[model samples]
Target: MSSSVTPATLDYLAQRLDELAAQFPTSPDAVDLVTLTDDIGTLGHHLQHAIERAQERFTAPETVYPPERVALVRLARAAAGIARALDTLAEALTYATTGFQREAVEDLAHSPLRNDPEVLRIMTAEKYVAARARLRHTAAALRTASTPAGSSTPRTTGLQTQPAAGPQPRQPNRH
Candidate 1:
């Protein structure tokens, strides 16, 4: 894509992830499951927007169909992926938990009546953290695999190159 992810967008995503993480153990008890459900939905919405922006800004012009139309199609596919992930997670949580708490999350995740920006913001953060953690873990595993057994990463030395000598001339001084 021609347009890279902007700093502002990264910051926005980070802020949202932080908010979502903060609500974890406490928020679950406070409002039941609405927070989690809303967050997941928000994540889906944000991904949809992101995919649209990416295709519009990054894709080459010679791609057959119109830019906006192509972006929309890609956006829909991305949104569908997010929705499926949310549905699976929601179903698992519902099946695994009991009482008002489970009900709350289930309702929020599946709710057709409400859509809150705050909740979505938090959910977006949740997804970011989860994805980042996965990336870090994968990186660590790869590093470990690539490293030689019992060998530490090699250190760098600060040395400059010297020019090779070809010939030297001698000078005589007269008294």
Candidate 2:
């Protein structure tokens, strides 16, 4: 089952893509990773609408030819993969930013954010199992980055260092 999207929605998608592309970092660095991930994550976020629209159009067979339907299916599948990867990459990057707590793996897995239907959709996809494991491994690396030489845990920087409990930039579906 699928639904229809209006021309105005498609226009908004195109415009958002344009805006993001223009805002992308001109010269990238460690700091730029955040911006890059944010832009790419936004792209992935918006791509979901394209997938939905394509699926919607595919269901409305009378409006498009057989070849068009085939194309729509292809686009939808492609969009799904891209969106999942984008989110995964962002998750990995964000995980790298802070000190890893052994409890974080469980904290995030059981966190309330996991209950969100959309976040669940991406997280439960086949790729996320590895992403979760990577989070574990990444946490070990964080142990190194976060703590002082003698400490076993992250030192307080007086900085709010925790990333959002789940896949970050978990954008609201903006279709």
Candidate 3:
């Protein structure tokens, strides 16, 4: 099943690649493209693995939990996206040059999507959508986690709610 990507994961993946790129041997002396590519390669593989696991667990007929299934699906999508991005980075790295052979390349190696406008925009969009979906899941989880047992009142769930004061005896109506 196809899954949507999230910002947290994207941010996490991007950061990993950024860190790796820091190890590349570039003109600036401090640039580390080779290391970045290696790091991203590893991250991509792990993301692919995550997608596979999510596929197995979520797509299984035996699992009936809607929320969990959805979460897994989302995770799978995000993982797939990350994997693809990493692949793209790897390809880009192969032809990679430093010191203004390409302006886009410089941007990419610097900021969000390494500061390349197109890459940054794409990553931002993916991150926003994914983050929203994750927030929804987190909210749902919080609601479920907070739900009280055997109480119909909306205010009476979990440890957050104060215990009822005391049992009150019913009084008979007097004329």
The per-residue C-alpha lDDT of model 1 at residue 157 equals 31
Cα lDDT of candidate 2 equals: 0.40
lDDT of 1 by residue, 1-175 (tens): 2433332333343344344334333221233344445545554555555555555544554432343333334434444544554554455244323322334355655554234434533443444345434323332332232212343322223211111221122112101
Question: Of the candidates numbered 1 and 2, which has the greater lDDT value?
Answer: 2
Best by lDDT: 2
Candidate 1: 10-residue stretch with minimal lDDT: 166-175
Q: Look at candidate 3 and tell me the lDDT of residue 19.
A: 38
Give Cα distance to truth, residue 154, candidate 3, Å: 23
How do all models score by TM-score? Answer: 0.35, 0.37, 0.38
- Encode model 3's per-residue lDDT on 92-121: one tens digit a residue: 454343222243455445434443444433
Clashes per model (N, Cα, C within 3 A): 5, 0, 14
Query: Who wins the TM-score comparison?
Result: 3
lDDT of 3 at 98: 29
lDDT of 2 by residue, 1-175 (tens): 2333332333344344344433432221222344445645565555655665565565656666444444344445445544554566565344434312221254665466544443333333322344333333332322222212332211212321121222234223221
Off by over 4 Å in 3: 1-29, 97-175
Model 3, residue 173: what's the lDDT? 24
